[model samples]
Target chain A: MRVHELETPAVLIDLDVMERNLARMAEYCRRHGLALRPHTKTHKIPELAHRQMASGASGITVAKLGEAEVMIQAGLTDVLIAYPIVGREKAARLAALAERASLTVALDSEEAVRDISRSAQERGVRLGLLVELDIGFRRCGVQRPDEAVALARLIHDLPNVDFRGVMFYPGHFMAPEPERRQLLEDANTRLRRFYDAFERAGLSIGVVSGGSTPTAFISHEFLGVTEIRPGMYIFNDRTMVGLGVARPEDCALSILVTVVSTSVSGRAIVDGGSKTFSTDRYRAGDGRGFGLVCEDPEAEVEALSEEHGHLDISRSSRRYRVGERLRIIPNHVCTVMNLHDEVYGIRGDQVEAVWRVAARGRVR
Target chain B: MRVHELETPAVLIDLDVMERNLARMAEYCRRHGLALRPHTKTHKIPELAHRQMASGASGITVAKLGEAEVMIQAGLTDVLIAYPIVGREKAARLAALAERASLTVALDSEEAVRDISRSAQERGVRLGLLVELDIGFRRCGVQRPDEAVALARLIHDLPNVDFRGVMFYPGHFMAPEPERRQLLEDANTRLRRFYDAFERAGLSIGVVSGGSTPTAFISHEFLGVTEIRPGMYIFNDRTMVGLGVARPEDCALSILVTVVSTSVSGRAIVDGGSKTFSTDRYRAGDGRGFGLVCEDPEAEVEALSEEHGHLDISRSSRRYRVGERLRIIPNHVCTVMNLHDEVYGIRGDQVEAVWRVAARGRVR
Candidate 1:
């Protein structure tokens, strides 16, 4: 069925466009001699993971175990879990995952290495681990080279865990006119220093990984980085747009919403709301709630009830009446895609196929 | 199985307590002489809806057409959609739903009345409509009594649409206690006046519905209201707690999460993140995020990533450590329950059943 006939608030992804988008990134990675490991957390579709593998990606990176499991089951063998598996439950799960494929998990602590090793040895599987050194985005990962060396040493000494490489994400460095050279040099120094420390301690550093979508453009100049994991580049978003990584049309996914009401002369309401766009409002210089345009630049999703999207439309946008549709490129595409069960592959106006969001509600 | 044996970041409901909660609400409505029309949007489980009906509820209220369809398929004969459905796609679905069961829809405009009438005319059954009046939420519904009268007139004049009654929400009025009486009075008076206008215009004003867990406490005082549509009273949350509506123990739903990590002697991380507690972080007063401490009242869910819940514990909660299980009462139970596909029913510490959240993603 066509997208319009399907329903409002449904996720539409043009398969032909998505493939081109996927192929475009794949081509870029190949041209740059970079091993492409697209993050599966962006789409969470096992089919997309398989497609990415077929398009010549060296491996795939998943944010959560639930995503890793889905991709592994779909026959995309090489998987990198780019998050710390800290708890006993997850450690045990990661051990099982390691047995299924060439699994590499990121760790930022000696305790994590010990806990993961306990599970890995029990399962008779060796887990390849990366020391996540922080370049920016101070969420997870070891901050200092000394901490990285200690964690790497611990992983290297573990019974069933191997220290593959050191990873760092210069997420905050993804500037539009990226301070490309300085950021790359900084990342190289941090990673190489950490990697060298492990080597000095009589350890082999095999993999060096980092960089997200915004910083992906300068992947060739990555210092001491053997590989990069750039996920959002597959389906660019307003976040990418704001970072000047990709243009609006480059985004493969969009929420196709129909005008649900137009009773008020100049005010029209769409069928999508917080349940669709979510509460991730990106002001990106001057955009309103999420990616929606409003009269005032500082437009918050000003007000969102459960089912209604209260957009304070600009005067020109208000002129657009009921029954029309608008394509909303979300600030964070991953979160928006996670909210739906399926996304349509749209070729122009034709809905080529509906792909099941196989990993939906896989929040573990 | 024990609750701890289950995966981290899972939805949990105390079945015994939920049954008790249902009976309590049903009993209160009965004693107060009001027809209980529980909004199924909170739970969206047919089993719960059936239990609600069995416990003396007159009917179920759904927020979307997909929800109504699911309820009808589950043998719920009478359902009221508390959302304004306006498009051809949804209108057609609503008409088809009317053919399956006794359906009532909320409408706030003459255009919506025309659309519903058109859809109803296509089907053999007449559409039951409730004129929604604005009671200060200022989100949807007609502003004044006369505007509601105009819509009522439109519905009454239509051949296939029946003007059922007046429906409005005093959701904003549900502010603990001091302002609730005044808000309730003001909203009910406006609604009753519209009901009178409908009556004077010879239109049937069968149901006068209003809602909220906070205001539902004083529902007995709302004599003109025909039915009450309180949703979250079953799974009382932080919002209810903040409004002084219900105490902590009264909450039936909670997220069962495992502590995944601990940062030295400082912060502890859980598997429950935005995906589990959901990204619905509306701080009531000064609370940082969307959940309350299940064990310690002073602690609140401070931050959440897509897959990590960063709970900021007070200095008193220092005893909480890694590998321990904690129950979290979400800030908004309706949104949290909607985020998951299933919820485990627990009795004491044993997981008795795993109920699929069948109508979980019917946000359309």
Candidate 2:
């Protein structure tokens, strides 16, 4: 099928651009002597994960065990769940996956560690553990260095769990250009304190994993970081462009939508809305609307309802008639991918392949 | 399975509360002498739609053709797609659905009518058309009464399409108490002008359909309205409560999540985030947090990442530890339902049944 022949509000991925993005990230990691562990939460497609591994990614990172299970079932042997897993059900599932794969998980609480340890022991499998450090994003991770060391010690003392290393995320460092460089430096300075604390306690931190798309290129500035796990690098979005991480043309993913309604004076409605493009705003507050209109740059997506994307075309030089097709580079590609069932891999005007978003809605 | 035994970040619907909500709306429509066409976009479950139809609903309304197809496949013979659908793919699909079901579509453009007319002619099926009027939503629909009459005439002259009536959505009338009443009155006054124009043009408006959850009860005050299409009445949310339409206790849908991390100082993280509960905020901007914490009302969900819901527990008397379960009444239940795959129907503490969100991710 051709790109224009697909139905409206369909997710389209430029295969050439996506391959270039994968190769660029892999080459960057090789040059920096770092292991690339691309996060699978971005696309949630096992085919994409296999492509990443073929392009030289050491392993893959997942946000949940549900996503990890999908990747593992697709024969991706090395997996890292970068979130805290609690409760008996999740712990048992994680331990079961470890029996046939190199499974590792991150945690910050002793209760979670104990549950995982028991599950691993019952399954007679060894599991790797990484103590999560709160580098700046206050959403998760242990705040104090002492607390992280305590959790590391607890993991070492467990029956089947080993203290692998530590992990941190600098989600607040998404700034433009030189300013972002300074923010990454500041975040790295704070991360070094925890690294030193763990070293002073005679703990061997073999794997110091941390990296987001915003700081993917400059990750080497963070001392003691051995690996990078950037998800959105595969399909950069408007947020990434606004943060100076990627150029507008480098954005590989876009929603192919049509102008469904143009009766309103200044606004036109597209078929894609919050359900397809999502309501996740840009972090920099760039005020670049919901996304960038590839066909008409001046047209802005002012707001979105459940199934309607309101495009403000008052400033555009060209007028869009009803039924005309347009492509939109969403503000955040990860959430947009999660909302769709299948995505078309396109090269130029033709669709190369169709891949199911196998792990979509796997939020468990 | 018991409620406690279910997985975290799960959507749970209280059967008793849901039944009560359905009964109240059905009785209201009966007393007002209006047909109730409940919108299935709220729950997107066939079982729930069957319950509504059994409770005296005339039919069901959907936002997309994909949803209409799902309902038709489940044996629903009557469905109205309340959106402007363009493109050849959608027109063909809509015509095909019209063959098996009493399908009606709302549109405001001549091009759309011609496309649907051609598809209906190709399939040898008659489609019911509604001239969509912009009742101040500014999202879609014709702007003026003359424009609506022109489209109605076009529909009347089409090959296999019949001009059924007019449709309007008072989306901008969401407010609290006396203010909401006044807004609804102001909107109705505008709607009366359009109805008068259509009547003067010798067009028989068989079905004047309009209603939103915020103004569902007061829809009878609008003189020309013959039917009400309320979607959120099935599963009310914080937005409905803020609009003074439904009380907090009236919300039937709630997300059951477990506290995954409490190591952070004044906050704790839950297993659900934008992926589970969605990024839709409260419309009133009442600073009510993402959703109301049912167990600890004082606990505010200050921030949300992709996989973590950060709860501010400074004002709460209760201290939430890791693995502690809590229920959250989402700000918008419709979008929340679209995010999950399955919802549990619960009676008290026991799970009565588990129903798949049959029409979820149907954003074509």
Task: Provide a comma-separated list of chain B TM-scores, one per candidate.
Answer: 0.94, 0.98
What would the TM-scores of all predictions be? 0.91, 0.98
C-alpha displacement of B346 in model 2, angstroms?
A: 0.3
Docking class of 2: high
Residue A219, candidate 1: C-alpha displacement in angstroms: 4.7
Clashing pairs in 2: none
TM-score of 1: 0.91
Best by DockQ: 2
Candidate 2 off by > 4 Å: A176-182, B177-179
- Model 2: what is its DockQ? 0.85
Compose the digit string of candidate 1's lDDT tens values, residues B184-272. 77766766676677668677778888776777868767648778999987778877777777777788899988765554234566777
lDDT of 1 by residue, A253-322 (tens): 8877666554434355667766677666452555545664423333334555567766555344335445
For residues B119-227, write the lDDT of model 2, one tens digit per residue.
9999999999998988777888898888888999999887999999989888877666777767767777878888888889998899989998988998898878899
In terms of TM-score, the best-performing candidate is: 2
